[model samples]
Every structure is written in structure tokens, then in C-alpha cells.
Target: MPVTDVITDPENLTLTIHADFAAPVERVWAAYSDPRQLERFWGPPGWPATFTAFDHTVGGLAQYRLTGPRGEKSSGRWEFTRIEAPTLFEVLDSFVDDAGQPMEGFPAMRMTLEFSPTAEGTRMVGTSHFDSAEALEQVVAMGVIEGTKMAMSQLDTVLQDLRAYAQGKGTRLELLDDTHVRITRLVEGPRELVWRAHNEPELIRQWMLGPDGWEMTECVAAVAVGDTYRNSWAPVGDTPGQAFGFEGEALIIDAPRRAVTTERMQGTDGPTTLNDLNLYEEDGATLVTVLIEYPDLATRDMILATGMVDGMEASFRRLEAAVLV
Candidate 1:
């Protein structure tokens, strides 16, 4: 579901796919470099892949076999043509015989993988180039597009596990009172950097995004007492006039220590909620505590039922990577 676009261009003999992950570029790159991680999501659903041999350096080779549900197996190999750490790589992908030889008359494609940091998270752009339009169409007819989509969808689970491992522990959520909720996490970074990432508009846009395919289109923060902060977000692709955002006013601002704000959701007449953010350095890392006070218990329950906790956990994981790593 994180895959936003899949384009097949016959004129250029290329098949391109765009996927977004709620993790840093380094983590995303590791999913490809590490054979154990690569085997987790390298094949389509119901067809798990096992890597027989893997060497991730330039001119190196990788061999894998995907086993279908009905005891069927398909072998493949990748000849690494180029390697650029944490950003880009190129490979010659082809079908191989049981003896590890390239299959004759099968269409071999050149693949380029690109990883870049975006406003929300890391964007992976994969382009596969065939020798000719006929060859490209041949692969497309063989269900390559759908297979790729299903395979990439599995990355979300892999990324989530990687994030939890990197953060040391999962986020903690508690109901403080009938109308209050508290969330806390130990982030791997300095207090000042964590504070800057939350207060600065430019840094906020990079990690505050709630989910994949959504971006903060507008962010204006006035980080002083009585100043107002306004932000907006919408889908990143092709959907116009559909937006959800909020505006808030600063009530208390203590740089690198604490901040209090009153936030009102856009297009809603509900009572404004109070948000308190406190930061501290503990054992060379930062501890971020957020307390939310709703107008009533119903409002708090509604927010909790909306899965905001999961979304916030995803956002904070990105924040940890952007600020510290």
C-alpha cells in the first residue's frame, strides 16, 4: 500500500515504481544490502524467496529461488553493475537455470534503484530497462507489475520492525485521566536537536507527516508566547482540493525544555485541545513526553479510536532518524 505509482513506458522500454517508507534512507538501503532482511520481502505474497548466495558489492552476484504455493520454484540472479552506498545501485536482473546459468531466450533487464529523503520519509524509485519494447511488454504480460506491487507492500512490515529495533523500545501510551492522555518515548538524539526538529517549520515538515502518501504542504510556526502556528497537509499524488490541517497558538515556550500550545482541527467546531511537550536529556539521549488534554472524555476516546497513537509512533520514529542519524 505504500507504493504510490507504477508506470510502464513502452517508448522508453522501462518499468518504474515509486514507494515510500516511514524510515530513514540508511535503513531503507540496508534492507537491500542485508541478505537476511532482503529475503523477508523480496518476493510476492504467497511466494517466499530464499537467497542461496548474496554478495552486495559491485560486480558481485546474488542468487535466489522463489517457491510458489504449489511446490513450484523459480530461480533468478542479479549481477551488480554499480553500487553507491545508501543512495543508488544498478543491477542486471535475469532468469537463471537450475545450474545457475542465465536462461536463453528470456528477457533480461537492467534495474536501477534510487533512495532519497523526502518530506515524509525515504522515497524509493526503481526503474527496470529492457532491451526493446517487445521485451518490456513480455515481462509486463508475465505479471511483473502486480508481482512488484505485492512484493513492495511487504516492506512496510519490515520497516516497522527495523524502526522498533533501532529505537530500543516501543512508544508508551497511557491514559492519564478521564480527559487527558500521555505519550512518551526515548529518542536517540540530543535535546537541542529534538527541540529544533519540533519547533522549526522546515524540520517539522520532514518528520511530522502522519502516514505514507501524505505531506505537509504548508508549515508556518511562530515559536513565541502568544504567537500562532498554522500548517496544512494533503495527499502527495493527483488528489486536489482534499486537505486536512490544523492551526495552533503558543501558550508557553521554553526552548529545549518545554512548550504548550492550543490546537484546533480544521473544518471542525469541536473544542480546542491543549498539547504539552516536554524534553529532557537522560543518559546522553533525549526523552520526549507529550501530554494531551481534551475538552471531554468523549473527545479523548474518539481520538484514541482514530489510531492516532500508531500514526504518532510512526512519525516519531522518522523524527529520531532525521534528527540524530
Candidate 2:
């Protein structure tokens, strides 16, 4: 699990939370931008939230209710004051009555959410400024800290499903054969943009590496039927001149649509694998499907045992973030 840190400053009357996700900044931002996704994880465990009104632009208003296990309910309203897509937003949040009016004698907080790129993925920093120390303490006594942590912890699964649904897969994995594994997902970008991210060496270097602290030191892409490409990566603290990577040949190339490659792993005496990559536009987004064929069932099973699926998922999530830029 990624580290989640919460800090409260009595002098400043602020509560700040710092959390990391193995996803791109844009995807993380979607949790707030998309009301349906927001409602899915906005409240703590056992207190599911429902959004009655949501407007994402500046000066918009959002109203929601959280129902407790014992049939009790709490309502809140957020008045948005700032809008910055995939990066930052600011809102004034306050308790609301059943009729959607602000409740008197309750605390209101000015909240700011900031997303930034990090070596591993995206780091979200959220700060809530209360009018007084008493207000901050009031919220803390209401389990705001623990509730927020529980809500944020649910993001990993949300992101996984989001990526899959965006690609039209809906959390399903397709297996073609004993020696082949196919991954199909919706990339939230244009077909050309998604293709460029996959075919261009620089763009590939930006997101293809599995996680943070790893750099693709060398990247070369020749997008032709008979052309070849090579990519190499090194960990941040590794000694200079020590790197591991792969080189592959482009067996088939159909620009911005489909391509096939024969890949060989570096520093290993393993059988070469064939990769078939296809991209298409569907319902205003790009659908990307990748088929990886190993030499045999044993080889495929061995690779799967190394936890490559998780690494691929992380890489694809980063790719989703990259093309949005």
C-alpha cells in the first residue's frame, strides 16, 4: 500500500492529507471531476455517499448525502471557486440541511486539492482550512481523518476499473490461447495521440517504465515493417553503465492502427515473444489491445508468475495519463 499521511495544524486551523496512487494525475483527478466516480468513494466505509447535484466548473455547486448504517444521514454542499483540470481545484465545503441549505452553527472549510507528477505515479495533496481551531477539532472528532483515509484507499480499485471500462473491457481479461495473453483497454485520448504515445520513443520513455525511480536511459523506435527498436532502463541508484532492457523488430506496421513486433529480453536466454498491438477510435476514445505470445504455455506461466500483469497495468495507467497531456 502507498503511504497516506495526515497532518493537523492547530495554529493554522488546517488539516492536510498526502497520499500517493499508482495512477496518472488525470485519472486521479477524475475522481473529483466525475460525479458518479466521486460518489463511489467520497464517503468512508459503511457510509456510502450519494450525489444529488454536481456541477464541476468554477462557481458550480455539489450536494451529497451520506447514509450511515443505522439509517442516520449527513448532508454536505461544496461551492466551487476554482477549476483547473487534472491539476488543482478549490471549493468551500459546509454542512447542509435536508433541504440543501447551509446549516447554521456548523463549520465550513475552504478545501484545495492539488495533483502532481511523481516518480512512482501521482501525489495528491489536499488541504482543508477551517475558520477556527475549534472547527477543525470538531471535524476531527467526527472521524474525518479516518473516514478520508478509508475513502482514499479505495482509489486503487476504482482506477483499475476506470482504465478497463474506458477501453470497453469492463474489468474483464481476455485470454486468446495457452501461450497468448491479450490486454484490451480504453485509453482516454484520441486514436492518433494514443498511437503516437505507443510508437514514439520519447513518449514511450515517459510512461512505459513500470514504476517510479526507474528511467529509460535509451529509447529508439523505427516504425517500419522491417525496422527495429531498442529500449533500456536503469534504476535511479544503480551504478552507471549497468542497465537492463529489450530490443525488438517491427514485423508489421500500420500507422495509427496496428503493429506487430518480435521482442527479445536482454540479459536473459529466454525465447523471443511476439506482440500484436492494435488501436482504434471508439465512442470518442481510443481502444488499445495488445496480444503477447510466448514460446509455450510454460514460458507464459513463468512470466505471469513474475507479477508482470501488475507492472503492465501500471504502465498502461501511466500511458493513459501521458496521452491526456
Candidate 3:
């Protein structure tokens, strides 16, 4: 367990948490700054957070939602007020709705996170300042202490590993639920190059070809919301496969950071899937995460059974060898 102490003061209207990790301060700070690593332990065991918007600069805002075991979601936002790199950062945290507006009846709190070097490793100290004693009591009554303990307990695994998680794993798949699946891959390239490889027609054609014997016949780039993108692939020469294609409309586009789209097979009226792609860079590599939401369990299973991961792995390898190189 990472948490060493928890103190609640009704008089001061503060709740403080102290956690120790057996890792360097920089490593621990990376676990918090990187959204992918943050997602691994930002919520309790049953609820996992998905950060849709994260800006780590002063005056920036982050929006995230925690999804329960039964698909229930609670949204929240953080407005960053102070940032001092790997040592200290502070934010105004508040509960928000799906539209990112603060919800009524829930009080906002100022949260300060501080990290310091320790004899053993790193010490993480967090304090939440509430407006009134009643406001502090309200969150405590909502089981915030217990939930935070459970959430921070999972961070040990994230910090202990030297090899960054999923760095060598070509393409990883995690079934989030019956209709939701997440795919992650560490691309050996910078974020801007990876983002461009997915958007530019020429770059996409060079790496997105699934296998050795296929070629991208058509590629239509989508750069804005509501814009449509279509891609087709055909087996070249005597390669044994029929031509197929996919088409989608961009729903949200955030340049080199994230994109959300609705995708479906070409020439078919079947149900569409929501694909959310996020990119985060550290050191010199970028982590690409795609969360796909299918229509039902049957569709999810059918798609996975189609050797999609293997194809994605092949494409990722080609991306490094051909485009990123």
C-alpha cells in the first residue's frame, strides 16, 4: 500500500493524505502527469477514470469521468491553478456534469499535491481545502477517505516497474466491459509524427496496410468535426483476400492529442462503433490508446475474433519501420 497516513481536521476544514512510494520522485511524478498511467489508478477498484481532456498548465482544465461497474458515470473537472513541475501542483476540483459544467449542491475544493525526496524513495503529500467544515464533512460522509485509500493503493504497481508498462508490448487489448474495449500501443515516435501518420493520406498508406500482401487503395483524410474519412484495402498480386474498406465521421478532433470518431464497415448499414484515440508522449515515444465502444456484446466479440489485434500489431511494426524511421 502506498498510503502511510490520513488526517482529517474538522477545525481546519482540511483532509490530508501522505503516501510513500519506493521509486524516484521523477518516476512517481510521471505516473501522475501521464494520463494513461493516471487512468490505471485514479479511481477505486470498481470505478475507473477516463480523462477526456487534460491540460497540465496553469489556468488549464481537465475533465474526467469515472465509470462504475454497472456503466454509471460521475463526471468531474479540475482547474489547474499552480504547477511547479515534479514537486508541487494545485487545482480547484469540482464535480461536473456530462457537459463539463459544475454541478449544483456539490462544493468545490482546492487540492494541493506535493512530492518530496525521501530516504527510501518519494513521499507524496496531498491536502484538500474545503470552504467550510460542513463541506469537508460532506465529502467524508461520501466515503472519500476510503475511496482514496483504495485508489492510491493501486499506484505501487505503476511506480515499481522500470520498463514502462506496455513499452515492448506491440498492441495490447483490454476488455473494459461487454461493449467497451481499450487498445494500447507504445509507438516508437513522437506525438506529432504519430498523429500525422494517422491523418495524412500518404503516411497512413505506408503503415496502415495490415499485412505484407495488401495495399491501401483509397484514403480520405478527415480533419474536422463531421468530416468523413474512408479507407480501402485490397490484396495485391496473388495475395489471397478480398478487398474491404471502412468509413467514419470525425466527432471530436483535438489536433495531436485526441480524436473521437464513429466507424462502420463500408457498404454496410450495420451498427457503428465509437472510437476514441488518445496520444501521450514521454521521453521520445508516444503512447497511443484507442477506446472502442461497440453496439453490443456480440459485435464486440465478432470484431475481436477477426484477428484485429494481430493486424494492428503488424501495422504498428510497419509504422516504426517505414514511416517513423
Candidate 4:
């Protein structure tokens, strides 16, 4: 199966982030304690941020920008409720403008981040709590559910790099899933190289379809099936992009190996896809292949008519260079 990004069951509203930084508690604390330093690595990979006030003392608050609501665009903030330095930091985060006006009825969601010293470095956990069931459901419908995943996805990378910097050596994160989907490399490349390419922007954009007068602008995955897949892609001018890109949860994901899964979205209807990736090694050569299975006979026909095969080919070529080199 493929990797997914969010919890869509309405019942599964708690968003969590549990990770370890391969650095001492002091080092990890330093990264978060300094507002100047914290902004350097907040939110997801592409979304840069700016902080207003950051006091890492007890009962201090931290405010920053991640984005605006309604694409009102630019700047988001978090108002702190509790702060305990190297140990914990809590706040209410939302898509508020610089003026601190929150989005409609969405209240300031409370989040708590905890830091504990580990044998190697620091162990961290991020958890958010909504004020009410109604508010939680409302935000989920408003796309914040997936938006949060994108934010987390970006943070995962930042911490990973920070760990490498602290340890002076790279560490690997292996996520493999079990499902009918298959993953493989049609082109020859080492597994390590291909993995890195998946994280590269230039390479991702090459086959991301943003240029076909369309794009896969926002790809947020929750890492499991029945979670959430939110894609927000818009046309540069008047290209009239196809609906809201792609959305849905991952059926399965097999990391450091092959994976298979499908993603669905708003306009895609019952748009379900079954993907498969197969990986094999021969004399240090890695071969990977990605196959997708559409739901129902009608969807299969629809995909073929949309030149999906060509799109897949283009995507693989881009992946080859992005990952292989």
C-alpha cells in the first residue's frame, strides 16, 4: 500500500507528531528556544515563516506566520499558552492574518510540544487539541486537516537534517506498507539515490503537472490508509486547473522497499487508485516500477483517455534523474 497523511474519520481528530532528534536535549531545545532559529525550520519544507514574539520561559507565548486563510495568503501565527523551555511548549495555532484575526468560527487550536532527552539526543512529541467537537469538524472540512499534514511533513525533513548535522552522519527512515499496490524502478539507480530524489523540488515539479497549465501544488500525505490526502493545485493564469488536484488517503506504503496505493480527491468522484511499486537489486543496481490500478472499468477508461500512461512515463524519467544522480 501507499503512505497517507491525515485522519478523516471525524473520530480520528487528534493529530500527533512523535520523533527523535539525534542530538542532545540542549541542542534540540536550542533550535526551538530561539524564535529566530525556530522560524528557520517550522511548518513544512516550502512554507517559510516569520515569528513575532518568542519567549522560551514559563507562561510565554510564541507567534509566527505559516499562511493565511482563504488564500488571503501570507502569514500565520501561534499564540503561546504555556512554555517550559527544553521540556515543553504549548500554544494555540491558526491561519490568522498578521492582525491576529482568526478564520471564521475556527478557534485557536491548542498544541503542546514536549521535549525529553533520549540516549542519543532528544525525543519530541507534538499534539493538538481543539476546543470543541464542532470546531474540530469545521476545520477538518475547511482543509486544515490536510494542511496540518503538509506542515508536519515539512517538519519531519527539517528534524531529520538537524539530526544528521548533530550526529555528523545521515540516518535512514524506512517506511514500508502492506497492500496490493506495487512499487518499482523502471530505470536503474541505487535505492538511496532514488529516495532522495523524491524529496527534491525541481525534480518533483518536472512531472508534478503544474506546467501542463496544472500542478500538484500541495501534496500532503498522512502515512496510512483511511487517513487524508489533500492536494491544492491552481492554474497560474486562466488554465482552469482540473478541480482541486488529487486528494485521499494512502492505501499502503513500503519504504526503503517498494510500495503500492491509491489517492482520491474532491472532483475525482469515487476516484480510487491502486498503486504498486516493485523494487529489486542486481549487482548493486536498483530497479523500481510503479503501477496504478483505477477503481471500476469506467475509471480505468477515463485514465487511459487522459494520457495517464504518457504522464507516468514523464514522471519516471524525472524520478530517474532526481533520485539516481
Candidate 5:
């Protein structure tokens, strides 16, 4: 295997490392807080890691189950000791058995991370202290220092993602329902095919609709921050529900992931009523969560009374067919 990211000093118990990355202090700080961002970047060159939990608070702990080079799954934990945002953090680190029971032979160590703000980005320093020189030697031999270095590099990639988000280049959650009903469906084809169907305007009309014969006549979408859009749904083959063409604001348009929000119609003729829209991916499938915080229990009752899930499911099935093609 290639050497771990650590530079070794063959005789000491104090292992120190200083590396500089090109990123801002705030962005670097965000990488520490966001676990999805962490998993995207932190691991060895070939050994990708998956995080189980990461709550970055002064007393919180971060845990990970990493698949090692030889396909062995190794677990580690970091208990945060101190945190001073955008500046420094310290934690107690340890390796453990499969169930997080402290291993009989594993040693606990203190790991401190210090951050220095710089023009290019931030300079990071890591210090690890073992209980004894022999314990330290065993850690080095077992590749702890290398793992630390690899983790740091992964951290760097995380900082880059934070920068992208700050620059408005990302898939961001606009709003989430305090209470929501998620509609999940397996598209007939690949996930990408399903996703594409949801995004195409032409296909959106096939599935998305109003009550009786209410058709989508016109629509325009702005898929990004600070972008507003509208859609017009007109009554067609008139049957039961015909609430004059609904149209409102695209308050949040995170199109990178095909999410949007519309300020739904009010009363039966007023301006808006509903709140937001969110889309998420799951294990080989996708979810659509519509967050509609009502003005009162009455409005909540109003939306739920409309059999919206039924309409939405119908739309989704059409979307499935369109995209699968």
C-alpha cells in the first residue's frame, strides 16, 4: 500500500503535521460541520469511506465505518473536546470493535486540530499524542498517521464544495416541511432517466395537473437562487374541479436537483397558499416532498382534502414513462 498522508519522525510520541490548502476559513469550517461534504472528500486515494454519523459540536462525536484497502471494514470515532468556529477544534480519538465497544488492544489518543486563516486559504496543524512511545510506534506502524493525512486531504475536498455552495453553484434545500408526506416511486428505468423526466418541461405537463380536465397551458421555470418562475394551468375537458389556472412564485429553484417551490393559490381566487417543494435521492429511487405550511388548520385541511397525493402520483407515473423513453 502507498504511504499514509503522515510524515514520520521515527523516535517521538508527539506526531505533528502542518499542511496548507487553498480555501477560505469559513468554507473550511463548513466542511467540518457537513457530513455529506465530508464523505465526498475524506479517505485514502483508493479507499473511499462512508460516514455513519458526524455531529460537529463541542461535546458531540463523529463516527465512521471505512472500507479498508483489503476490503476490511474499520471503524473510528472522534469525540469533540473543543470547538472555536473557523479557528480550532480538538477531539479525543479512538478505534473500536464492530459494535463500538472499546477494543481490548486499541489505544485512545488526543487529537488537536488548529486552523490559521491565510490569504490563499487556511493553514492546518494536527497533533496527536499517544500514551507512550511504544503505543505511538504501534499506531504509526498500524498506519494511523497515514489515515489522519488522508482524512485531512478529504477535508480539503469538502472545503472546495463549501466554496461552490457559497458561490451559488449547488443543490441546496430551499425549505423543508416541519411535517411532510413523501411520495416515492421507482421509475421504470435508471435513476438518471427518472430524474430527467421530472425536469423536462414538456414531460412535466403530462403528469402535473389540476382537478377535472385542468390542463397546464403555459409554464416557465427559473432553476436557481434569486430566480422566479410561473406556470398557468387552464381548465380542459371540464369535469369536476376547475379552479382557474393556478400560477405563482418559484421561490426556490434548485434545478441542479430538480427542486422548486410555488406560492400556491389562495381561497379559490386569491394569490397564493402553499409553501415549498423539495426533491431528494434515495437508494436507487427518488422522493418528492411538498412542504405546505398553512395559515391555519383549515388551509392544511384544504390542501389535504384535494387528494393531492393522488394527482401527484398520476403525474409521477406519466413522468416515469416520459423519462424512461
Candidate 6:
């Protein structure tokens, strides 16, 4: 986690956060000024931010929304007030409606973010100035401190190149909590091709096979919301494994960008898992992120103990070798 200290001063009507990163000042500044990188860690876990508009000039504005796990949304805006390249910037932040209008009862805050070179790397200081003590206390009580900590912790991942950070790591899993786990893989391919490899049956059959000696017997991909998808696999001759499949309905689809689905094992009445898949492309490589919501800790452990990650890693390697190349 990059955040080292958080201070809330009611008398000063301010909340300040201090963070240290092992990245240079220019790199740290770029992460905040670039909308694509900013959205990667702008919101806390389970709630991801999407920036609709980003204008980084002194008088420009940025608009974004944080989408919750269940499709709920909270919109906000930032009016840039000052900029000093890789050193400092300031913005007027406020809650906004979907139409880009400021919310009625919410007050805006002036946020100043400063970056400085340190011996190790870069040090950041973020201060939010509120209109009154009441406003400062209001946001603090709403879990701003904890949310900011979680959000900033994700910056380390963004500060490094996706391929450098995740390629050799294969399919990695991070248990976000009792019910949520984040899985990631980096593939050397365009985002469009990666999306096609997942949705097109021909491409899927070429790479979705988990391990050697296994064949994908059936693949019915879901292309839109409410569409159902099923995929089955069987071991090849002399291979020792049982035949099984998974069935799911797509809950959301933003072709070549993101997809969310509910997955359950075929012929089972057990709890289902919500799989949210997101693909991001930088240069020619795509980072595939899947945020899964399990029912409970027991279910999460049981699924992971089934050698699921190993199978996923094998399939991803094949994806690059067979489908991507």
C-alpha cells in the first residue's frame, strides 16, 4: 500500500493523505493526470471508476462515475484549478448527477495533490479542503479514509507495466475479502483479439482447453445481456478426468471492454459466482482482469483448492500461443 498516513483535522476543515511510491515523480504524476490510469485505482475494491471525460488543463474538467458491484452508480466531477507539471495540481471536487450537474445538498472541496522526488522514489501529499467542519466530518464518517487507503493501494499495480508485473506471474489471484477475489493475466495481444478469443467458438476451442489431453467438447458463448453460455470439456483418450461443464448467463456486456456473468457448474444446485471480466490494452498487450464474487469463504476455498488456478494458467499460455499469435 502506498498510503502511509492519513490525518483528519476538524478544526482546519481538511483531510490529508500521505503516500510514498517507489516510482519517479514523473511516473507518479502521469498516473494521476492520465484518465485511463487514474480510473484503475480511483475507486476502492468492488467499486470501479470509469472516466467519461478528462481534460487536464488548468481550467478543464474531468467527469467520472463509480459503479458498484450490483450496477449502482455514483457520479462525480473535478474542475481543474491549477497545474504545475510533475509537481502539483489542484481541483474542485464535488458530487454530481448523471447529467453533469452538481448535486443539491453536497458541497464541493478543493483538493491539492503535490508530488516531490524522494531518495527512494516519489512522495505524494493529497489535501482536501472543506468549507466547514461539518463537511469534513461528514465525509470521514462515510468511510472516506478507509476507501482512500484501499484505492491508493491499487496504484502499485498501475505504476508498473502490466506485462512486466503480470506476464510471468501467470494467472494470479488476490483474495480481496471473504467473498471477492481478483484474478489477472497479461497476454501479448490486442484487446480486440483477446475479446474475440473469449467470445468466438472457433478461437475459444483452440485455446480454452485447460491442460494437455483435454478437449473442449462444447462452447456456447453469450454475446449480450441475458444470453446464456455453456462450455464443456472432456479428457482425451487415456486421460483420467471426469467430464464437466459450466453454464452462465451474461449480466452485462461491453464488447471488447468488459463482461459480467453468473457462472454455475452444470447439473449442480450450488451457489453461483459472479465473474466480471475486464480487458485493458496498453501498446499491443492486454491485461485481463476477472473480479469474482463468491458466496462465502468456504466456497472460495473449495473452488481454489480444485487446482483451478493451475488450469487457468495453462489455458492462458495456450491462448497466447494458439489464438493470439
lDDT of 4 by residue, 71-186 (tens): 12355566667877668888777766558667665466777888888786677777767766776777667666444454443333334433232232211222222211223333
Write candidate 2's Cα lDDT for 208-234 as tens digits: 887666788889896887888888888
In candidate 2, what residue range of length 10 has the lowest lDDT sum? Answer: 163-172
lDDT (C-alpha) at residue 303 in model 3: 92
Displacement of residue 289 (Cα, Å) in model 1 is 34
Candidate 3 per-residue C-alpha lDDT over 72-171 given as tens digits, one digit per residue, 9 for 90 to 100: 6788899999999899999999999889999999989999999999999999999999999989999999999988997897687567542367678789
Q: Can you give the TM-score per candidate against the true fold?
A: 0.51, 0.51, 0.66, 0.42, 0.48, 0.94
lDDT of 1 by residue, 79-100 (tens): 9999999899999999999988
Candidate order by lDDT, decreasing, is 6, 3, 1, 2, 5, 4
Off by over 4 Å in 1: 162-325
What shift in Å separates residue 223 of candidate 5 from its native position after superposition?
Answer: 34
TM-score of 3: 0.66
lDDT of 5 by residue, 132-194 (tens): 877778887887666656556545434543233223221122222333322333334444555
Overall lDDT per candidate, in order of appearance: 0.82, 0.78, 0.87, 0.54, 0.58, 0.91
Model 2 clash pairs are 119-212, 166-186, 167-185, 167-186
Stretches of model 4 off by over 4 angstroms after superposition: 1-13, 67-74, 142-325
TM-score of predicted model 2? 0.51
Which sections of candidate 2 miss by over 4 Å? 1-3, 162-325
lDDT-wise, the better of 2 and 5 is 2
Off-target runs (Cα >4 Å) in candidate 3 are: 1-92, 95-103, 109-163
Better of 3 and 4 by TM-score: 3
- As for lDDT, the candidate ahead, 5 or 6, is 6
Which residue pairs collide, candidate 1?
Answer: none
